[model samples]
Target: MSNIKKIVDIGDKELEVWKSGKGRTIIILPGMMSSLAEWELLYEELSKEARVIIYYRAGYGKSDKGKIPRNCTENAKDLYALMKKLRITSPIIIGHSYGGLILQEFVMKYPNEASEIILVDSTSYGAHKLDEVEIEEEDGSSTEAWVEKCKIYSSLSKEVLQVEMAEWITEMKKNLSSSQHLEVEEFMSNPVMFESLSEELEHDLLTCGETNQHKSFPNTSTIVIGRDPKASITEMVESEGLHRSEAEEIELIWQTLILNQTKLNYKTTYIMAEGSGHSVHLEKPEVIKKAVDSILNSTEVED
Candidate 1:
């Protein structure tokens, strides 16, 4: 497969997009604080069967940082516009983490434009509610504390930033292979990554609020894959200061929320990645590939 990279002007700003393979289009949407390179493994695998479009969101990679107040609505609109400009029709949409929320808004607004939707370990509507768990920090308010931390992160020297990012990539390598981790590390080395992430976090609450309003999503073929909540129960309890029992209860609540996601559509399938964490696509690419293939094959049968 050959990679075709291009910059498309989206009125306000330009987005860097990469396309490869041929056939049905499958657009991969990256999560918060991530670039298209984060999907390198899955993109390589999926592109073999279908045309894949991966783009850096505004403020990441070579993409221009557009205006602020960039909540889910704005994100969804930008993606829809890009698809229209590219003349992509009824494409399969795959969203990871926060990208899933944007996908939700997209399907709701342009129901006819999407053939299927796959949400990989996506965030729940209740994600904005953090008061249930006590997050460890010097300040009581986690949001305010996080904002202050971002300021510190933004001010770090390039060498210190690289070191910090390397450490993070090393931790992520536990879930991803060495090469995959290296690719992600290289993409994240861009200073703009942190800045974009901070800007996204600034509108987290607003984004979730907008998502909450769209409880009834379009009735389309949808797949919801959630990482096993058991994988993080202990970490949540120990690090987040939640009681052991509380952590277990929270896990159950999370699973319930994930299951509830299927209610958004008429034909929806839910899967749990047995040993995977939130980054199921990276940790268990086979699971994701199988899901995508299943959707594609099913779509073919219907056609």
Candidate 2:
């Protein structure tokens, strides 16, 4: 019931693809550090009613890692090229996390390509600004004082702390949109690439956060935000300098940003997945599916 193949000339690398169904076209984009495998459930469900195309991004899954740019805009351009290569027109896009951000870029950058967007736990900022974070050292001195900082880079990133609560760990892992994999493993192994990617991602993500005002979609869109527990929220508020009101404010700003830029008289829906984190798809796929289906049904094409 499923067909799998590889396309070698899409982006800077090959895209491993799984395609099914035969009706309206839908492209499923998974989160960073995740591949098409993460969309198995949603793919299966959507395939029953629509043609679904699922593929891994460059540097993910069976996709090759070439010398292309790694920023979200580049990723979105690659996606557009792939779809054009495959001759798909006006597809419905299901994007999660970084994939969601890529979809946003695609919709804004190529307004004619997609009919709608489903944003799953996307990050947004009213302004493209980054917080200045302090790096702590074990010696209680500034990171500048550490002479061999590069030596400990690999150790710090790869080190996974042992969890005392199995249930909580299981739940946490379930809710993650992405996780470490072979490519991530390789990046973590190479200190230079690791640090380089981190710094690049820092600037890229800040740009994405700030450029939210310029991004828009032409059709219908929906956003799902996974709510962490009150305890977790409290901790984030205290440690990250974000109050509960700030979170609410950010959500409101995010909605307004997308709604204003949308060109197709866009209808927007917002869903809050309670007791979950950013990884609502993995932690609560059913909830996401229900929300997605609701949007698709509401915007069903007339006969």
* Candidate 2 local lDDT, 114-137, one digit each (tens): 876777766443323212233232
- What TM-score does prediction 2 earn? 0.66
Candidate 1 stretches greater than 4 Å from native = 135-144, 155-160, 172-186, 210-215, 234-243
Cα lDDT of model 1 by residue, 123-220, tens digit = 66666554455534524445555556666676776567778778666665565556566556655566666666665666664346444475457788
Q: Which stretches of candidate 2 lie over 4 Å from their true place?
A: 125-200, 209-266, 299-301
Q: Predict model 2's lDDT versus the native.
A: 0.58
The alpha-carbon deviation from the true structure for residue 80 of candidate 1, after best TM-score superposition, in angstroms, is: 0.8
Count of clashes, each model: 0, 2
Q: What is each predicted model's overall lDDT from 0 to 1? A: 0.77, 0.58
Best by TM-score: 1
